[model samples]
Target: MNSQFNFRFSALLILLVATLVTACKKGDNVVPSPDLGAQVAGTYTYSELKTGGKTYPASDTNLKGTIKLTRQTATTVAIQLAIVHKATNETFADDAAEDVEVVESGIGNIELHYNGDTIAKIKGTKISIEGEDDAGTLFTLFATK
Candidate 1:
Protein backbone atom coordinates (compact mmCIF):
# COMPACT_ATOMS: atom_id res chain seq x y z
CA MET A 1 0.00 0.00 0.00
CA ASN A 2 1.08 3.62 -0.68
CA SER A 3 2.13 5.84 2.28
CA GLN A 4 -1.07 7.94 2.18
CA PHE A 5 -3.29 4.86 1.85
CA ASN A 6 -1.43 3.15 4.73
CA PHE A 7 -1.90 6.24 6.94
CA ARG A 8 -5.64 6.45 6.11
CA PHE A 9 -6.10 2.74 6.76
CA SER A 10 -4.37 3.00 10.14
CA ALA A 11 -6.56 5.95 11.13
CA LEU A 12 -9.70 4.07 10.13
CA LEU A 13 -8.63 1.02 12.13
CA ILE A 14 -7.95 3.15 15.23
CA LEU A 15 -11.34 4.87 14.90
CA LEU A 16 -13.14 1.52 14.54
CA VAL A 17 -11.41 0.09 17.62
CA ALA A 18 -12.21 3.20 19.64
CA THR A 19 -15.87 3.06 18.60
CA LEU A 20 -16.13 -0.61 19.53
CA VAL A 21 -14.47 -0.06 22.90
CA THR A 22 -16.79 2.83 23.73
CA ALA A 23 -19.81 0.77 22.73
CA CYS A 24 -18.72 -2.11 24.96
CA LYS A 25 -18.23 0.15 27.95
CA LYS A 26 -21.25 0.55 30.23
CA GLY A 27 -22.98 3.88 29.75
CA ASP A 28 -22.76 6.28 32.69
CA ASN A 29 -26.16 7.77 31.89
CA VAL A 30 -27.93 4.46 32.51
CA VAL A 31 -29.04 4.09 36.13
CA PRO A 32 -30.16 0.91 37.92
CA SER A 33 -33.33 0.46 39.99
CA PRO A 34 -33.37 1.45 43.68
CA ASP A 35 -33.11 -2.17 44.82
CA LEU A 36 -36.72 -3.25 45.23
CA GLY A 37 -35.65 -6.78 46.11
CA ALA A 38 -33.44 -5.56 48.96
CA GLN A 39 -36.50 -4.05 50.53
CA VAL A 40 -38.10 -7.53 50.63
CA ALA A 41 -35.72 -8.49 53.41
CA GLY A 42 -36.45 -7.67 57.03
CA THR A 43 -38.93 -8.23 59.86
CA TYR A 44 -42.67 -8.04 59.30
CA THR A 45 -45.33 -8.10 62.03
CA TYR A 46 -47.77 -10.92 61.29
CA SER A 47 -50.94 -9.48 59.78
CA GLU A 48 -52.26 -12.66 58.20
CA LEU A 49 -51.75 -15.31 55.58
CA LYS A 50 -54.20 -15.20 52.71
CA THR A 51 -55.56 -18.31 51.06
CA GLY A 52 -57.54 -17.76 47.88
CA GLY A 53 -59.55 -14.64 48.82
CA LYS A 54 -59.71 -15.02 52.57
CA THR A 55 -57.11 -13.67 54.98
CA TYR A 56 -56.32 -15.88 57.96
CA PRO A 57 -54.79 -13.87 60.75
CA ALA A 58 -52.12 -15.55 62.81
CA SER A 59 -52.96 -16.97 66.18
CA ASP A 60 -51.59 -15.68 69.48
CA THR A 61 -48.93 -18.32 69.14
CA ASN A 62 -47.72 -16.68 65.91
CA LEU A 63 -47.13 -13.14 67.05
CA LYS A 64 -43.74 -11.98 65.70
CA GLY A 65 -42.72 -12.44 62.09
CA THR A 66 -39.50 -11.97 60.14
CA ILE A 67 -38.59 -12.18 56.47
CA LYS A 68 -35.02 -12.30 55.27
CA LEU A 69 -33.24 -12.26 51.92
CA THR A 70 -30.54 -14.85 52.46
CA ARG A 71 -28.97 -14.52 49.02
CA GLN A 72 -29.39 -11.71 46.54
CA THR A 73 -27.52 -12.18 43.31
CA ALA A 74 -27.66 -10.84 39.79
CA THR A 75 -30.09 -13.47 38.52
CA THR A 76 -30.95 -15.40 41.68
CA VAL A 77 -32.54 -14.66 45.07
CA ALA A 78 -33.08 -16.64 48.27
CA ILE A 79 -35.63 -15.69 50.92
CA GLN A 80 -36.76 -16.93 54.32
CA LEU A 81 -39.82 -16.36 56.52
CA ALA A 82 -39.90 -16.94 60.26
CA ILE A 83 -42.43 -16.58 63.04
CA VAL A 84 -41.63 -15.69 66.64
CA HIS A 85 -43.34 -15.21 69.95
CA LYS A 86 -43.81 -11.55 70.88
CA ALA A 87 -43.25 -12.18 74.56
CA THR A 88 -40.46 -14.75 74.40
CA ASN A 89 -38.82 -13.42 71.17
CA GLU A 90 -38.13 -16.98 70.13
CA THR A 91 -38.20 -17.77 66.39
CA PHE A 92 -40.39 -20.63 65.25
CA ALA A 93 -38.36 -23.61 64.10
CA ASP A 94 -40.77 -25.15 61.58
CA ASP A 95 -41.51 -21.87 59.82
CA ALA A 96 -37.89 -20.86 59.18
CA ALA A 97 -37.04 -22.22 55.77
CA GLU A 98 -35.47 -20.51 52.75
CA ASP A 99 -36.75 -20.26 49.21
CA VAL A 100 -33.62 -20.66 47.15
CA GLU A 101 -33.67 -18.96 43.75
CA VAL A 102 -37.24 -17.94 44.36
CA VAL A 103 -37.26 -15.16 41.76
CA GLU A 104 -35.49 -13.94 38.65
CA SER A 105 -36.05 -10.28 37.96
CA GLY A 106 -36.51 -8.57 34.60
CA ILE A 107 -38.23 -5.61 32.92
CA GLY A 108 -40.57 -4.24 35.61
CA ASN A 109 -42.13 -7.25 37.33
CA ILE A 110 -40.06 -10.01 38.89
CA GLU A 111 -41.52 -13.50 38.38
CA LEU A 112 -41.10 -15.74 41.42
CA HIS A 113 -40.75 -19.48 40.78
CA TYR A 114 -40.95 -22.27 43.32
CA ASN A 115 -40.92 -26.01 42.65
CA GLY A 116 -40.90 -25.44 38.86
CA ASP A 117 -43.94 -23.17 38.81
CA THR A 118 -44.61 -19.42 38.95
CA ILE A 119 -45.71 -18.22 42.36
CA ALA A 120 -46.23 -14.47 42.01
CA LYS A 121 -44.89 -11.23 40.52
CA ILE A 122 -42.93 -8.53 42.34
CA LYS A 123 -42.74 -5.04 40.91
CA GLY A 124 -41.15 -1.87 42.22
CA THR A 125 -41.87 -2.21 45.95
CA LYS A 126 -45.04 -4.31 46.08
CA ILE A 127 -44.77 -8.08 46.35
CA SER A 128 -47.41 -10.61 45.31
CA ILE A 129 -46.90 -13.98 46.96
CA GLU A 130 -48.80 -17.27 46.89
CA GLY A 131 -48.34 -20.37 48.95
CA GLU A 132 -46.52 -23.07 46.99
CA ASP A 133 -48.78 -25.70 48.54
CA ASP A 134 -51.73 -24.13 46.68
CA ALA A 135 -51.38 -21.77 43.72
CA GLY A 136 -54.82 -20.26 44.30
CA THR A 137 -53.64 -18.74 47.56
CA LEU A 138 -52.36 -15.15 47.16
CA PHE A 139 -51.12 -12.39 49.40
CA THR A 140 -49.91 -8.86 48.75
CA LEU A 141 -47.10 -7.30 50.82
CA PHE A 142 -45.99 -3.70 50.60
CA ALA A 143 -42.29 -3.04 51.19
CA THR A 144 -41.73 -1.01 54.31
CA LYS A 145 -39.11 1.70 54.26
Candidate 2:
Protein backbone atom coordinates (compact mmCIF):
# COMPACT_ATOMS: atom_id res chain seq x y z
CA MET A 1 0.00 0.00 0.00
CA ASN A 2 2.85 2.42 0.82
CA SER A 3 4.55 1.64 -2.48
CA GLN A 4 1.36 2.31 -4.43
CA PHE A 5 0.84 5.50 -2.47
CA ASN A 6 4.39 6.56 -3.20
CA PHE A 7 3.89 6.03 -6.94
CA ARG A 8 0.71 8.04 -6.88
CA PHE A 9 2.37 10.77 -4.88
CA SER A 10 5.29 10.93 -7.29
CA ALA A 11 2.92 11.18 -10.23
CA LEU A 12 1.02 13.92 -8.46
CA LEU A 13 4.28 15.79 -7.83
CA ILE A 14 5.22 15.59 -11.50
CA LEU A 15 1.82 16.84 -12.49
CA LEU A 16 2.07 19.71 -10.05
CA VAL A 17 5.44 20.72 -11.46
CA ALA A 18 4.10 20.67 -14.99
CA THR A 19 1.12 22.71 -13.97
CA LEU A 20 3.28 25.32 -12.31
CA VAL A 21 5.58 25.52 -15.31
CA THR A 22 2.64 26.13 -17.57
CA ALA A 23 0.60 28.45 -15.38
CA CYS A 24 3.34 30.57 -13.83
CA LYS A 25 4.76 31.56 -17.17
CA LYS A 26 7.13 34.48 -17.61
CA GLY A 27 6.15 37.71 -19.33
CA ASP A 28 6.04 37.80 -23.15
CA ASN A 29 8.39 40.78 -23.03
CA VAL A 30 10.87 38.85 -20.91
CA VAL A 31 11.89 36.14 -23.39
CA PRO A 32 9.75 36.51 -26.43
CA SER A 33 9.61 33.80 -29.11
CA PRO A 34 8.95 36.27 -31.88
CA ASP A 35 11.04 34.05 -34.12
CA LEU A 36 8.49 31.30 -33.62
CA GLY A 37 6.21 33.26 -35.91
CA ALA A 38 8.98 35.23 -37.57
CA GLN A 39 10.46 33.06 -40.33
CA VAL A 40 9.21 30.20 -42.49
CA ALA A 41 10.84 27.17 -40.95
CA GLY A 42 10.30 24.39 -43.53
CA THR A 43 9.41 23.70 -47.13
CA TYR A 44 6.07 25.19 -48.18
CA THR A 45 3.93 24.01 -51.13
CA TYR A 46 2.14 26.72 -53.07
CA SER A 47 -1.22 25.32 -54.05
CA GLU A 48 -3.06 28.62 -54.22
CA LEU A 49 -2.47 32.34 -54.59
CA LYS A 50 -5.13 34.44 -52.76
CA THR A 51 -4.72 37.47 -55.06
CA GLY A 52 -5.86 36.95 -58.65
CA GLY A 53 -7.50 34.01 -60.40
CA LYS A 54 -4.29 33.02 -62.11
CA THR A 55 -3.73 29.28 -61.65
CA TYR A 56 -0.58 27.32 -60.97
CA PRO A 57 0.52 24.50 -63.24
CA ALA A 58 -0.05 20.91 -62.18
CA SER A 59 3.59 19.88 -62.69
CA ASP A 60 5.80 22.90 -63.33
CA THR A 61 5.19 26.65 -63.15
CA ASN A 62 3.61 25.89 -59.82
CA LEU A 63 5.01 28.25 -57.20
CA LYS A 64 6.87 26.09 -54.71
CA GLY A 65 9.93 26.96 -52.65
CA THR A 66 11.51 27.30 -49.22
CA ILE A 67 11.67 30.66 -47.50
CA LYS A 68 14.18 31.01 -44.70
CA LEU A 69 12.89 33.52 -42.17
CA THR A 70 14.81 35.10 -39.31
CA ARG A 71 13.29 37.44 -36.79
CA GLN A 72 15.57 40.39 -36.24
CA THR A 73 13.43 41.65 -33.36
CA ALA A 74 9.91 41.75 -32.06
CA THR A 75 8.79 44.18 -34.72
CA THR A 76 10.93 43.05 -37.67
CA VAL A 77 12.17 39.94 -39.51
CA ALA A 78 14.23 38.93 -42.52
CA ILE A 79 13.09 36.38 -45.12
CA GLN A 80 14.66 34.94 -48.23
CA LEU A 81 12.57 33.23 -50.92
CA ALA A 82 14.36 30.60 -52.98
CA ILE A 83 13.44 29.97 -56.61
CA VAL A 84 12.63 26.31 -57.24
CA HIS A 85 10.32 26.02 -60.23
CA LYS A 86 11.83 23.58 -62.71
CA ALA A 87 9.60 24.06 -65.74
CA THR A 88 9.19 27.78 -65.10
CA ASN A 89 10.92 30.15 -67.50
CA GLU A 90 14.11 31.87 -66.45
CA THR A 91 12.53 35.29 -66.65
CA PHE A 92 9.91 34.21 -64.16
CA ALA A 93 11.95 32.06 -61.77
CA ASP A 94 15.09 34.09 -62.39
CA ASP A 95 13.11 37.16 -61.59
CA ALA A 96 12.42 35.52 -58.25
CA ALA A 97 15.32 35.46 -55.87
CA GLU A 98 16.49 34.57 -52.36
CA ASP A 99 17.79 37.77 -50.82
CA VAL A 100 17.88 38.67 -47.14
CA GLU A 101 16.49 41.93 -45.79
CA VAL A 102 14.38 43.24 -42.94
CA VAL A 103 10.69 44.06 -43.22
CA GLU A 104 7.65 44.96 -41.16
CA SER A 105 6.16 42.09 -39.12
CA GLY A 106 5.01 44.15 -36.18
CA ILE A 107 1.34 43.37 -36.79
CA GLY A 108 1.75 39.62 -36.42
CA ASN A 109 0.80 38.62 -39.96
CA ILE A 110 2.16 36.25 -42.57
CA GLU A 111 4.75 38.48 -44.26
CA LEU A 112 5.32 38.00 -48.02
CA HIS A 113 8.64 39.24 -49.40
CA TYR A 114 9.52 39.03 -53.09
CA ASN A 115 11.16 40.83 -56.02
CA GLY A 116 9.52 41.86 -59.29
CA ASP A 117 10.90 45.35 -59.87
CA THR A 118 12.49 45.70 -56.45
CA ILE A 119 11.98 43.69 -53.27
CA ALA A 120 9.01 44.45 -51.03
CA LYS A 121 7.06 42.85 -48.18
CA ILE A 122 3.32 42.29 -47.81
CA LYS A 123 2.16 41.15 -44.40
CA GLY A 124 -1.01 39.10 -44.46
CA THR A 125 -2.33 35.89 -46.01
CA LYS A 126 -3.53 37.53 -49.20
CA ILE A 127 -0.03 37.65 -50.76
CA SER A 128 -0.26 41.32 -51.65
CA ILE A 129 2.79 42.78 -53.43
CA GLU A 130 2.40 46.52 -53.73
CA GLY A 131 3.27 48.57 -56.85
CA GLU A 132 3.95 45.88 -59.43
CA ASP A 133 2.97 44.77 -62.92
CA ASP A 134 1.19 41.90 -61.23
CA ALA A 135 -0.31 43.76 -58.35
CA GLY A 136 -2.27 41.48 -56.01
CA THR A 137 -0.80 38.36 -57.53
CA LEU A 138 -1.49 35.71 -54.93
CA PHE A 139 1.50 33.92 -53.40
CA THR A 140 0.59 30.40 -52.36
CA LEU A 141 2.87 29.10 -49.66
CA PHE A 142 2.76 26.55 -46.84
CA ALA A 143 5.21 25.78 -44.08
CA THR A 144 6.81 22.45 -45.01
CA LYS A 145 7.40 20.25 -41.98
Cα RMSD (angstroms) for every candidate in the order listed? 6.8, 10.8
- Which is the leading candidate under TM-score? 1
lDDT of each: 0.53, 0.45
The sequence of per-residue lDDT tens digits that candidate 1 reaches over residues 42-68 is: 444455455556655555233546454
The CA lDDT at 132 in model 2 is 27
Candidate 1 residue-wise lDDT at 99:
54
Superposed Cα deviation of residue 137, candidate 1 (Å)? 8.3
Q: What is the lDDT of candidate 1?
A: 0.53
Error (Å) of candidate 2 at residue 136 is 12
- Say which candidate scores most in lDDT: 1
**Model 1, residue 109: C-alpha shift (Å):** 1.6
lDDT of 2 by residue, 23-84 (tens): 77754337644453345333333333333545444243445544444555443445554545
TM-score of each: 0.43, 0.36
Candidate 2 is scored at a TM of: 0.36
